[model samples]
Target: MENYIVIIAIISSIILFLSAVIVFVRFYRERTQFKILLGVALIVLLAGSIINVFEHTAILQSAEEFEQILSILFLPIIIFAIYESIIGEQLRTHIKSEQMFKGIFNQTFSFVGLLNSEGRILEANSTACDFIGYDNDEYKGVFFPETRWWKHSAEEMKNLEGAIKQAGQGKTVRYETTNIDKDGKIHYVDFSLKPIHDSRDRLIYLIAEGRDITEIKSTRLELEKHKKNLEDIVEKRTLELKTANEELQLKNETLYEKNTIINEQNAKLVSTLIDLKETQTQLLQAEKMASLGVLTAGVAHEINNPLNYIVGAYEALKQKDTHSGDEEAEMLLDAIKTGVDRVAGIVKSLNQFSRDTPAENEECNIHEIIDDSLVMLHSRLNNKIEIHKNYFKDSFVTFGNVGNFHQVFLNILSNAEQAINEKGKIWIKTTKNDNYLIITITDSGKGIEKDAINKITDPFYTTKDPGEGIGLGLSIVFGIIKEHGGRLEFESEVNKGTTVTVMLPQKGMKHE
Candidate 1:
């Protein structure tokens, strides 16, 4: 029996020592108060186990009372450690996760809300609350179908209730609906309700999402009206042509000449219709560009004020005596300064690009403009595409609107970047030929086809996928070059590469 107790005591001491080592390592890594408490409790248990082993092995015969005291003290310390490390840590993590979710939920652009299994609104994002002029507090715990968004129309309310019911049955429901906003204006919404389930597939809650499609709906309606008008005009023209054909049949002696005249008229009408369509596309592109310019200008202006503040703060921080001789702090401050400078440069480029009014003709350095445009598009290149600049020795300076030249190079460089799929190289070169300065940009990308090369500069002609581009980039580039008394040229081969040449008259030469 004495030998058996000795063996058991040795095994318990071994287990307790291993546990204590693990707890101490965890404390060393995390260095938290809870971990410290846990490590101390583990050490106490390990000490008592060691004392028991010594007493059983006849090494310390009078330590039994001390072992009993240690055993008594171990219980409360372990309880406190368990409570702090497990329960307290889990509670903190839960609160942090909730805060992160709330931030994303409120910051999203779409209308979003959470509904309980019983179809009552539990939480609504800021966008949804503001759209209907109701606070989140006002909408909480209210039946989703009876909320302010659907309260104006009985049919809508009924439809929403049906959607909620379907969602509760584990079905996703999506449809377009109309709702009245806070200002009494009607909005078209693409709405959906999706059921959320627990790990065991039990229904827990529902997610409601809505996106305003009022502009798209209005544009579609306008297009339908125009299509109807065009149909009416075609019908009228057909009837007129039929009447003329009938008259020509009756006057057979003069049939040939009348038929020729009607054919000519028909040809002219078709040509006019084609021109009208081209003009409409151009106008639409112009409107989109105008809106983009306005947005860019506003954003640049907003960012500039904050950027100045950051620069001022960084300067002040660098001069502080507390951070002197600290290499890590100095490196961090340098990084902040570099980041601020980069943002300022981007804002300057945006301001220049957004300028619509033509400035007086100035001496623009060809290389500088190209460099600025590259900075603007650095994000797209992402270091995947290599840029090789082979500028002319003597800086090719020309007289033109600096902003227009910036736009020209920006559009060209952007096209070159988009042409490459994964990895490629872009080479920009400049040289002078007689009274003209020539700039060429070459890209090692999937080149344009022979058929598309000619039409690439035409308005609304694009080879890119839908929604990726509007195909007006080259058209705008062409217009800018022509305005500055320059000509644009393109050379390409399938799967090989493309070279774009831009030739502008040198300074002191007549632009006309």
Candidate 2:
């Protein structure tokens, strides 16, 4: 039993010595008061264990009294080490955490304050103190609702007092209210009171916070005012529109009746105007033919007598030139004959135009009629205008009023001649399409205006200078072509030129 006790004490001494060395090493590195206290306690324990081992093994029998004294000191030193390593460290950590929480609570931006359950102001952060122009100590013990922040407004104080009472009952209260700063300026505040509870769920403190909302409140009020104004304007305009609509409906009813009566009268007037225009056109044609016939007959009679004498003289000169064998005299005689023939041709064309006989089914050679018209207008087209004639290879014969067709070609060729200002061109093309003879006359003159082309064939609608033309020329042409079961179309462009197309039914074909 003694050996077993001595061996166990020796192992215990070794463990204590290792524990003491580790404690001393930690004390040296940390240099803390607790570490040094633990090291001293461990060293005392290790010394006691060594003395016990010496006594038990008889290695130091004279130290038996010292081992008993060390054994008495062992328990107190072990207790001291446990206290310094655990309990002391926990207490220091708690103190540091409390200091950090206080720093965060005071330095926040908003108005932050703490109140006891009795509604007394326990603590106010620096922001709250500076805003109300009060020192922290001055308002520390005052009732929260009666503090400097609420001194300017009695109503705000009553409201805050109620909120505090609610918060003390463990309820959170939030509201928008006004507060006065130190400079007496009123500021809108979003205020709240929140209750803090203990671990037992008992209300302990109230946390009061406020955020400035003066600018936000002002903007909201302005928006509401503008919205009200807009509604008023819209209501007024809607009423005005409704009244105007009712008046318009009444006017429309009245106008509808008047329009019915006016339209009846207008229909009668239009028919009368059309009949009068037709009568006027017939009278004009009759008078023009009468004058032309009389003029042509008188002119032909006066010229034919002299023309017969020249023809007799030319025949006698031709016989004399043949006997003398003179080429120059023969040429002179030929020239005289040519002049006489040309004059006779002009008289024949004028006679044709002057004829009042209307033969609606006369077989007319369109090429011959066009050639006669060109002959009549030779003086006007001699030097100033170029004439291009594209005749069909086959004969283009159409059944129409022979005299009327002669007058049609004459008036068209005359118009073409007069349209040329200084130097221009006229193209006369004749072609046979299906059972119709198509005649197209194009002129490179100053083109007619777009607005005037449609009205050109209307009676008395002239673009000529006064006393130059009666404007009945094209109207008469339109009438003659219509009478022969034909169509007339005019195409013109400003500053470009004009093209007139005439379509007349051929012989043995009916009008389409």
Cα lDDT tens digits for candidate 2, 250-269: 99999998999999898897
Candidate 1 wrong stretches, greater than 4 Å:
1-291
Model 2 poorest 10 in a row by lDDT: 282-291
Off by over 4 Å in 2: 1-7, 21-39, 54-74, 84-86, 89-93, 169-171, 197-202, 258-512
TM-score of 2: 0.48
What C-alpha lDDT, on a 0 to 100 scale, does residue 316 get in candidate 1?
Answer: 95
Model 1 TM = 0.45
> Residue 266: error of model 1 in Å?
11
Q: How many residue pairs clash in each candidate at the backbone level?
A: 0, 0
Candidate lDDT scores, in order, read 0.86, 0.83
